[model samples]
Target chain A: MEFSSKLLEKAVNEMAQLPGIGKRTALRLVLHLLKQPSEQTHYLSQALTTMRDDVKFCKNCHNISDVEVCEICSNTSRNHKIICVVEDIRDVMAIENTNQFKGIYHVLGGKISPIDGVGPSQLNISTLVSKVKMGVIDEIIFALSSTMEGDTTNFYVYKQLKEFNVKTSTIARGIAVGDELEYADEVTLGRSIVQRVPFEISLKNN
Target chain B: MEFSSKLLEKAVNEMAQLPGIGKRTALRLVLHLLKQPSEQTHYLSQALTTMRDDVKFCKNCHNISDVEVCEICSNTSRNHKIICVVEDIRDVMAIENTNQFKGIYHVLGGKISPIDGVGPSQLNISTLVSKVKMGVIDEIIFALSSTMEGDTTNFYVYKQLKEFNVKTSTIARGIAVGDELEYADEVTLGRSIVQRVPFEISLKNN
Candidate 1:
């Protein structure tokens, strides 16, 4: 047996399955959790369960939210005409942390990666396009990462929504190659948004 | 305010407080849990509360167990005459993983660290001394780490148990410098237990 206790070993094995956590690291976490106060363990268990049970995808933008529409999408104060499109909800959180973007969000779930078999059809592209067709969307901002797949996805998205009569943009300025929006400091990301360009020219430069 | 969602941010912050898990790692874990079906979260939450609420310290040996006396302490196959003393329950779990020793365990709860204000009185050393005097215990093994403070605590335990006529031994000779028993692989550790020397010579030489 890799571990003596069945329950403890199970916990460690489960932990090791997580990204970036190896068997040894998983063992350390399980052992540490075993030593923690009962209250702390209880809190963790509650949090883990509640995270999924209490949260649901926002109907409009597909962002993980507690309510059906999500607070941002429901709020009339948010500029619904301007939609920020991102790879995942993590990007939405990253943009929200900056507190500069007054617009609501639409999470694409993932970027287009042909090698990995993640195509535009697999993502929330149709939802985004359909949202744009609502006619009130004056600007659809592409906030995808600077990776190759990100660029490919942005190009496809721009092409798919060109028939619509509105300005489609992307957050391009100041971001470097192979960078994620989640890791960029608030100041740089905020400045990048301020200098966002239209999809027609932004596609070549980005 | 660093997080867009207050509840999620609170949960991530709490997870980040765990050993080896930082902010980014915590966010990853929270997000991973959020993606899973609610059942997985329920399992984790239930396990946390059950581990805390169902398990209590064994009054006799101080080892964590489900019942009054731990499985190890209550077992007739295990040598009741020998008690392996350790700083925490993790040490017990480590030694148990080796399956080399049949003796019971005694958790000190903590070590003798004056800097952290952990003196001998704070530990369950008195209960250990009482066990030695009871004549049922034929041998007492110190299975703590090889660090300076671990050595100091071992010395303190030795002086207290010195008056007892029973054979006083310690599990050493297999571990290296700055290594905790919990981190040591099972094979090397099992070999170490077979090669433990007498407490007096072992503690002084190291």
Candidate 2:
């Protein structure tokens, strides 16, 4: 789309570079910013730049943090003996919002997707294996998505930790909590059936 | 959602403040930025900040510009005597893209919407009137949207320019090009019938 001002065009171009945002959407966003108080734009730009330039990753789990160690890694209340392996920080956020997992998180930053040029070496697998080999972690829970890349990463990490004494497990694959069984895909329904737990264990949560 | 880093949370919150963006989408965008090189973030922030801080509006038409006058207003090839009145810069861009009009534009910024607390004084109406009253303007085309507020603003501006020598006209209202006549709304169909142009006039464009 044509823009009257070069500055407006540049801002729109930069905004449209973001994933899922097209030129029309970028123009609408930039125009919205132009209508708002200039302070809002300044705050947004300042916050983004500050985060990008100064943010750090936790030394232990590779999760984003302001300090050397993330809150979960530093907290004494969380279960340090268990680490929930996740594909990225968003997964950690999603799992944290559930308040179901009390263990610390190991953010792999990405999964092992060779098609996307992302391999095992590109992730934080080495540090995790080293952590497991250090003998502090008693169990490693794989909380990655149920995708091929997620499975590959899980297997790759599992192989590295196999020599260690730690127990490895994966999060359950089943229909979502509120979903109807009839609506569940056949593969997922079959897997859930085959992996059905004892009646007493399933009743405990409810 | 809980974030591992305070800076990441801050950046996501700021990003979500933009129109049409929600918390989940904001997190996705922030995480995407985290995955990219730092230079991309810097370019985005710098471009937005610079545009917000330095962009100017044309002195005559209130169109966004880098200099005192916008390109359309300054161009000698455009018909300066015939001005198209639009609600905002986007309309100017749309008309420019069509390659139909060679006239300069007067961007009102917004329409007269009492429900939204926008009044005539809040818009660039006075400057438009003064431009028309300058005695050089030949015709004023109302190219605003076909909404109630647009009609009100057009009528209000038309009243202000009525005492002047300039002729006023509104863009035609009819079934869209290539639209099925049977499916056209009754009001629009009736208007099209009453304001039907001569056969030669309608056939000339095709």
Candidate 3:
């Protein structure tokens, strides 16, 4: 779209660089910012700049944090020996909300997707391997999604820690609690049947 | 959703304040920005801040511009005797894209929407009236949308310029090109029939 001012065009172009935003959406967003008070724009810009310049990651888990070490990693009450490996910080939040896992997390930052030019080396895999080599961890749980990339990353990390004496397990795959068995996909249904637990064991969790 | 880092939360909150963006989308965008090079965030923040602080509006037509007077108002080739009133700069760009209107534009910034707390005094209507009082403009065209607010704004301006010698007209309302008559809205179809022009007049534009 044609913009009368070069400054407006520049701002819209920069906004459009985002993943899902297009030029038209960028223009609309920029125009909305223009219509709002100057302080709104100032705060937005300041927040983004400050975050980019000063945001830190948990040195141990690779999750985003304001401090060098995140709260979960430093919490003595949690079982740090049982590290749950996941894709990113969002996964950490999701698992934390469930309140079922008492174990700490190892954020991989992202999955290994070769098609997207993201390899194992590009992720936070090395640090995790080093953590595993320290031999302080008792069990490692793979909590990544069921996508191919998630499985590949899990397998790659498992291979890296194969020589080390560590027990590794993946999160269970089954139909959602409210879902009907008839509607479940074949792969998930088959896996759920094969991995069926003792009736008493399932009842104990409930 | 919970954010591990306060800086990330602040950025996401600011991003979500924009129209149509929610907390989830904001988090996704902020995370995407974090994954990119730091320079990307720097450029986006810099552009928005610069645009918000330094952007200027044309003194004459109130259209967004880099200079005191916009290009259209400063141009000697465009007709100075004709003025087309529009709601905002987007309308100016839309009309310009058509390449049909040779007259200059007078952007009102917004229409008179009482529900939104927008009044004529808040708009650029006064400057337009003063320009009309100068007796330089020979014709004034209302190109605002056919919405209630647009119609109210047009009528308000038309009343203000009633005593002036200049001719006043509105952009025609009719069935859009390539629209089937049977499927057209009743009001639009009725208006199209009542305002029908000579058969040759329709062919002239084509």
Candidate 4:
């Protein structure tokens, strides 16, 4: 689409650089900003700039934080010995929302996607490995997704931690609670059946 | 949803204020930015700030421009005698894309919507009226949408322009070019039939 103003075109071009936003959506967003008070746009730009320039990552788990250490890592009540390794901060939020895990997290930042040029070194894997090598942690739970990259990262980390004698596990996979068994995919349903827990064990959580 | 960091929370809150973006989508976008290089976020913020802070509107038509007057308004090749009044810059772009109308445009910025607190005073109607009173224009084409607010705006402008001797007309409404006749709505179909043009006039455009 042709824009009458150069400034509009520049803003839209920058906005369209975002992951899922297209040129049309970028145009709509820019126009919406034009309609709003200038202060709204100022606040949006200020927030983003401050976040990018000043945000820090936790030295322990590589999660975003305001200070040197993130809240999860510094919370004394949580079990720091048992670290749940996940992809990013969103997964951390999702698991926290469930109120299921009592341990802290190790944010890998991203998985090992070979096609996208994301390798093990590019992620926060080395710090996690060094933490495990310190032998303070009792358990290391692999909480990454079940994708190929997730599996690859998990395997790479597991191999690196083989020298250390710590318990390693992964989050269990099963059909979602409200979903029907008939709608479950074959791989997941078969895995769920094969890895089925005893009746008492399953009933204990509730 | 809770954010792990205050900075992340602030950025997400600002992002969620956008038109269609919700908390979840905002979180996703914020996390994506965190994953990308800091320069990308810096560029986005810079572009938006510069656009909102420095962009100018055309003196004659109120369309967004980078200079004192917009290119379309200053182009001497276009018909200065015919003025096509529209709701916004997007409408001007759409009509320009058609390449059928050679007249300059007067962007009203918005229609008259009492429910939304918009009135004739909020629009760019006064300048259009003053231009018509100058006795230079021969015709004024109302190309606003066929909504209640659009019709009200059209009537309001028409009343203001009654003292002038310029011929006033509205763009025709009918089923879209590629739409099936069976799928056409009753009101539009009936109106199109009632306002049907002469066979020679209809065939001339094609």
Per DockQ, the best of the predicted structures is: 2
| Tens-digit per-residue lDDT, A21-123, candidate 3 | 9988898899899899999999999999999989999999999999999989999999989999999988999999988999899999999998999999889
Candidates sorted on TM-score, descending: 2, 4, 3, 1
- Writing each residue's lDDT as its tens digit, candidate 1 over B1-206 gives 35546567767877787798998889888888776666666665665456546656788888765567777877898888888989877677778887778888888988999998889998899999898888788888888887778989999999998887878787655878679999998977998888776889767765
Task: Compute DockQ for each candidate against the true complex.
Answer: 0.30, 0.85, 0.81, 0.79
Please provide, for model 2 over B1-206, each residue's C-alpha lDDT reduced to its tens digit, 9 standing for 90 to 100.
78888899999999999999999999899889888999999999999999998999999899999999999999998899999999999999999998889999999999999999999999999999998878999999999999899999999999999988689998899889999999999999999999999999898877
- Give lDDT tens digits, candidate 4, residues B1-206: 88878998999999999999999988888888888899999999999999999999999989999998999989999998999999998899899998899989999999999898998998999999999999999999999999999999999999999988789999999988889999999999999999998999989987
Where does model 1 exceed 4 Å of error?
A: A1-18, A21-37, A74-78, A112-122, A173-206, B2-4, B115-117, B173-206
Per-model fnat list: 0.32, 0.92, 0.90, 0.82
Question: What is the TM-score of each predicted model, taking all chains together?
Answer: 0.74, 0.95, 0.93, 0.93
* Alpha carbon lDDT at B91, candidate 1: 79
**Alpha carbon lDDT of residue A200, candidate 3?**
95
Per-residue C-alpha lDDT of model 3 across residues B109-146, encoded as one tens digit per residue: 99999999999999999899999999999999999999
State residue B25's C-alpha deviation in candidate 1, in Å: 2.6
**lDDT-based ranking:** 3, 2, 4, 1
Q: Which residue pairs collide in model 2, if any?
A: none
Residue A117 error for model 2, in Å?
1.5
RMSD of candidate 2 to the truth, in angstroms, is 1.8
Using lDDT as the yardstick, the better of models 2 and 3 is 3
On lDDT, the leading prediction is 3
Residues A64-96 of candidate 4 have per-residue lDDT tens digits of: 899999999999999989999999988999999
Q: Name the weakest run of 10 consecutive residues (lDDT summed) in model 1 chain A.
A: A1-10
